[model samples]
Target: MNELVLPNDTNALNNLMGGRLLHWMDIAASISAQKHCNRIAATASVDNVSFKQPIKLGDVVTIKAKVSRTFHSSLEVRLVVWTENISTGAKAKSNEAFYTFVSLDENGKVMRIPELIPETEEEMQLFDGALRRRQLRLILAGKMKPDDATELKALFFPEI
Candidate 1:
């Protein structure tokens, strides 16, 4: 997903606000998750978000997201943000984040989702990284008293 950085997305100094950028990232992540789940996937949580560069008005903000991992009915999406200067056409990395989504059926209940098929090495790497992040999130949430990464890993991954 992409958006042209406009005045409304900026602050008093005309720089893009982190909140607005994060909102867009969530939208992008949801889009990617929904594409895979084919249902309503709501944001269950967001992991760390790091901004590496600042984007200004007139920059073409590009957000890329893909399903990195999944658990019973939850999906973790990895999002990368980039910006291209409208005039100079130079692109720079902006930020990155991980979003967790819970796929819901028409009754608004969590439903089973198809297994993620990692087609390439990049995807496999992303899936592995997302698994680590998911574990960290679970640990932070106090869901893992034993602090076992494998226990947390089992939550979002299927035995192949």
Candidate 2:
């Protein structure tokens, strides 16, 4: 997805507001999730989004999203946001995040999504990290016991 940052999309400092950028990211991620699942998907959560650089007005914002992994009815969509200065022809990485989405049937019930086989090395890396990220998210949401997150145990207990 590509968006032209206009004056209305920026804050007083002429930088694109975080909320607006988030909204665009959600749309791009939703498209990716829906395309993979072949069903409507609702955003379940947004992982931490750190703004590496500010996107100024008149910049062309490009959001690249892909299905990094799928579990049950939920899928993790990896998103990368970059900004290009039209006048200077310079591009910079602005933000990166993982958005979770649950595919739903026409009746709005969660439906199983298809599996994703990552072919490239970069895709494989993203696919491998999704489990740890999901475990962390579940632990933070209080939906899973910390002890059950085997993938996240290494962070606190390195010897494991």
Candidate 3:
């Protein structure tokens, strides 16, 4: 997904507003999740998003997204945002985030999603790390017991 940072999308400093960038990321991530599942998907959660650099007005923003992992009815989509200067053609990474989406049927009920098959080494690494991230998210959300996060526990207590 590509977007032009117009005047309305910027803040007082003439830089793209964080909320506007987040809206674009959500669209890009939702599309990736829907494409992978071939069904309507709703955003379940968004991981922390930190802006590394400011994107000025008239800059072109490109968002690349891919499904990193899939569970029973949810999938994690990784989004990378880059900003390019239209005149100089200079490009720099602006933001990166992970969004979780759940597939839904026409009745708005959650539906099963297809499994993700990681082929490359990097993909395999991301696939492996997704579980630990998910566990941490669940614990933070109070949906899972901290003691039950075996993968996360191993990171802090290697002997256990």
Candidate 4:
């Protein structure tokens, strides 16, 4: 998804507003998740979103989103945002985040989602790391015990 950083989308300092940027990211993430599952997907959670650069007004914001991994009913969409200055043609990475979406049926119940097959090296790395990320998310949300986060525990305790 690409968006122009118009005046309305910017703050008093002429930089893109964080809320507006988050709205755009959620849209991009939902589209990716819905397309992956072929169902109506809703945002379940948003992981750490760090803004690395300030996107100035008149810049073109480009958001790339893809399903990093899928669980039984939810999937993680990794999004990277970049901003390009229209005049100077300079581009910078603005932010990166992971969004979790849950597929839903017509009755609004959670439905199963399709699996993601990572073929490329980058995709494989993201796919492999998604499990640990998900486990941490679940643990933080109180849906899973910290000790039950096997992948994350293994990562923190390499000798285990």
Q: Is candidate 1 or candidate 3 better by TM-score?
A: 3
lDDT of each: 0.87, 0.96, 0.95, 0.95
* Candidate 3: tens digits of C-alpha lDDT, residues 82-126: 999999999999999999999999999999999899999988998
lDDT of 4 by residue, 1-160 (tens): 9999999998899999999999999999999999999989999999999989899999999999999999999999999999999999998898999999999999999999988899999999999999999999999899999988889989879898
lDDT of 1 by residue, 1-160 (tens): 8899899999888889889998999999999999999889999999888878788988999999989888889999988899999789899998888899999999999998778988899998887777677778888898865447874556667581
For candidate 3, list the clashing residue pairs, or say none. Answer: none
Off by over 4 Å in 1: 151-160
TM-score of each: 0.90, 0.97, 0.98, 0.98
Which has the better lDDT: candidate 1, or candidate 3?
Answer: 3
Which of 1 and 4 is ahead in lDDT?
Answer: 4
Residue 127 in model 1: lDDT: 78
* RMSD of each candidate relative to the true structure: 4.4, 1.0, 0.7, 0.7
Q: Write the per-residue lDDT of candidate 2 for residues 1-160, one digit (tens) a residue.
A: 9999999999999999999999999999999999999989999999999999889999999999999999998999999999999999999999999999999999999998999999999999999999999999999999999999998898789999
